[model samples]
Target: MHTPDPHRHTPVPPVRPTRRAAALALAAATAAVGLVVAAQGGAGAAVQGSLAADTQFYKDPTSQVVKWVAANPGDSRTQVISKRIASQPQGIWFSNYRPDSVTSDVRAVTSAAAQAGQVPVLVAYAIPNRDCGGASAGGAPDLPSYDAWVGKFAAGLGSSRTVVVLEPDSIALTTCLSAQQQNDRFASLARAVTTIHAANPNAKVYLDGGHSTWNSAAEQANRLRGAGVLNADGFFTNVSNFNTTANESSFARNVLNALGNPGNLHAVIDTSRNGNGPAGSAWCDPSGRRIGNYPTAATNDSAVDAFLWIKPPGEADGCAAAAGTFVPDIAYQLAQNAPDPSTPSQPPSSQPPTSQPPTSQPPTSQPPAGNAACSIAYRANSWAGGFTADVTVKNTGSAAISGWTLGWTFPGDQKVTSAWNARVTQSGAAVTATDLGYNGTLAAGASTAFGLQATYGSNNTTPTAFTLNGTACTTS
Candidate 1:
C-alpha cells in the first residue's frame, strides 16, 4: 500500500477539459471505429458477442469460440490492429515477486519467443516503496537493491526480441510521496529503462500509465515527464489493472498531448482481461470479467501504437487467488466472459476477429542466422523443491540446427521447480522450454539433455505431450 506523508503535500489542481479533448477524441474514434476489437465492445453488458475464434484456446482449447471463428471468417471483428502490434518486436514486463531465480526462466521464454519471430512483452515492477501503499504493495528493499536487481534483469535479456513495460502505477500512484521520494523513484525508473535498452538495442521500453481513472492527462504527462518518459520507447496504459480500451486510449493520447509528443509517443493497452470492462470500478481480482483480446499488433487510431494483452488473462491480482498463480476457475470465468461467436442464422455477435490460424501452436525451434535447420531440445532444468528430470532432444529433420527451442505442457497439478541451461516460460498449462544463458546455440548432429527437479504431492504417470519450434514433436 502506498502511504503518503500528509504534511508536505500540495493540493491537486483541477484539470481543464480543453486540454484533454484531443486525447479523448482519439480514443473515442478507436472505439467508434471498432478498434476496440472483440465481443466485449457491444451493448447488453460486456462486449455482447462470442469470443474471437482464437480466444477459445484461452479457456479449453476446444471451446466454441475457437471453432466458430475458424468456421466463419467474415463475422469476427478483424484483429488487424492487434496483428500489427504483435508483429512489432517489444519487451515483456517482469515485476519482482517470485523468490526463485526467474532470470533464466523469463529469458528462456522471451528469447525463444523472439527466436520464433514474436516479441515477448515484459513488465519490471519491483521498485522500492512501489505503489506507495496502494492496492499493489511490496517491492525490492530499496533503490540500491532495486538497481542491482535490474542489473541481473538486464543480463537476462541475452539477445532475445522483446518489449519492456516498465513499472505500472509507479508514477501516478506516487502522488502521496514526498518530492524527494518521487524524484528518487522516477530516477531509478529512468535508469532501469536505460539499462535494459542499452543491454538490447532491439528491446522497446515503455513507462506505465495508471489507468484512465487514476490520473488526468496533464497530471499523467507531468508525472511521466518527471519519470523520464521522454527517454522511454513510449508509455504503457492499463497494465494488470482496470479501464476500458476507449477510456485508456483517450487518457493515453491526452497524456501524450500534454507531454506534447504526437505519433512518436505511442501507447499500448492491457487487453488481457478487459473484455467485459471493469466490474463497477473494482480493481482487485474483480468478479464477472472475461479475457480481453489476446495479444496482437494492430492499431487503427494513428496515435495509438497497438493493443496488447500485457497481463496474461486468468492470472489473479492477489485476491481470491494468489497473485500470479494460474487459477482454472479464474480462467473459466475469463473464458465465459469472452464474447460468444456470432452466426449468420442468429443475431449479430460483437466478438473481435482472431488472427491466429486454427491448430496453431507457439514456436519451439528457431532458424539459425543463415540456415533453415530445426533441431533443438528443450528441458525443465529445475522445479520448486529440487525435483528434476532430463529429456533427450533429437534433430528429427535433415536440416542442420543453429538455434533450437522446446515447448511442452505440464500436467495440471505440477508447476516448475527450477530450470537451467535455458529459460523456462509458462502460460497456463503450456510450457515453452528453451536454452538459457548456459546453453542456447545447438549443433544439428548432436543431442542435448536438459531437465528440472519438481516436487508434487502425488506421483507422476506418462510423459506430457510437447511441441518443438511451434511444431508438435513426435516420439521416435
Candidate 2:
C-alpha cells in the first residue's frame, strides 16, 4: 500500500453534489429541453447510464481527482480529468495508522455507499512492514498493533456490501523478513481476516496474491493458504501493479486450482493502469500506460469477481511523485492514451472511410477467408538477453471463435522460457500458443491477450506475421 502524502494534500472546496444527484439533475434538465434536444443527447446519456447500471461499486465524489477538479476548474486539463478519472469508481484507501479515528473514517465512506445501494471498495493497508522498507514503507510499528487497527477498520463496514483488499504486497514480498517473522506475519494476517469477518459477515475480504509476474502460481497459492485465504472471500492480484487483465485472470485461476478450489473463492484484478500492459517488471510510475478496463463486477469469468480500480489512475507509484500523491499530468496522459470508446473496433487503416464499405462488401460467391477475420497487437519490453511480450488477439469476424491457436515466427533467435494465459510451444524460430480452456471463446469484436517471457541472444526483433487457427492475421 502506498501511503498518502500529507504535505501534498490539496484543500478540497466544499463537497459538491454526489454523482447520482448530478446525474438526476441533468436528466431533469434534459427533459425540460423537450424531445429534439434530448434526442440529440440520447447517445451520451445512454453511455453514462449504461456505465452506472453495469457496476455495483460506489463512486466517491470526494476522491482525489474530484477535489483536484473542483479546486482547479479553470485548468485546461480539468474537463478530461474530471470526466475520465474523477467520474470512475475507485478504491478509497485507509492507509493511515490511526486506530482511534479509523472506525469513523471508514464508516463515512461505507455508510454513504450503503445509502446509495452501492458497494464500497476499501483497501485495508496498515499491515506491519508494508512495502518492506521500499518507497511505500511504514505500517503499524508491530503486528499486534496492526491486528487491533484492522479490527477498528472492520467495525466501519457496518454490514454494508463491501470489498476489502487486505494489505497489498503483504504475502508476496516477504523476503525481507526472517523465517519466524514471516510465520508471525502470516498468523497475524489470518487473525485479521477472522476479525473482519466476525465484525461484518457481509464484507468480502481478499488476501493479496501478488501479480502474475511476481511469483509462480503454485508458490503464490501456498503463500495464500498460509495467510488464511480459504476462510476469506478470495485473493486479489495486481493491486497497484500494471499487469494485463488476461494474464492476471489466468494466473489467478491457476492459483485457485493449486489451492484445491476451496469454498466459493474468487479473485479480483487491479486493472486501473494496465491498458498498455506492463513495461517489463517496472513497478513505478511508467510512461505510456493507460487506464484499463473501467471498474466492473460483470466479468465474464466465474473465477474472477471483478476488475477494480484499486490504484486510482492519477496517483503516482513513488517514482514520479511521493507515493499516492495525485498528479494531474499523469492523469491526463493515462486518460488521453486510452482507446476512444466510440471508435470502431477495427484498427485504423490507410484507406479512406468512403472506400472502406465498398472494399468490405466482398462478393457473395466467396466468403472472406479466416485469415482476414483476425488482428493481433504485440508489445514487448526488452533488456539485455531477455524480454516479456504481451500479445492481444482481436476477433473482427461476424461470428464467435470457440477455440483458437495462434502461431508466429520470430525474426530473431528468441526462445520462449515461460508463458501465462496460454500454453506456448516453440520449434526453432516458430512459436505456437493455444488457449488454456478458460479463455478459449472470443465473441465477435472481442479481444483476449496472452503474454510470454523469452530470451534472445543479440537482436530482439519482434515478429511481424501472426496467424490464428492456421489462418493469417493482420498485425500492428
Please name the candidate that would achieve the greatest TM-score relative to the true structure: 2
lDDT, model 1: 0.50
Query: Which candidate gets the maximum lDDT versus the true structure?
Result: 2
Q: What's the TM-score of each model vs. the native?
A: 0.53, 0.67
lDDT of 1 by residue, 224-276 (tens): 88888787767877766544565566667678788887444677776655554
- The local lDDT score (0 to 100) that residue 64 gets in candidate 2 is 67
lDDT tens string, model 2, 262-298? 7569887776766655543445776766666556554
Output the lDDT of residue 133, model 2. Answer: 78
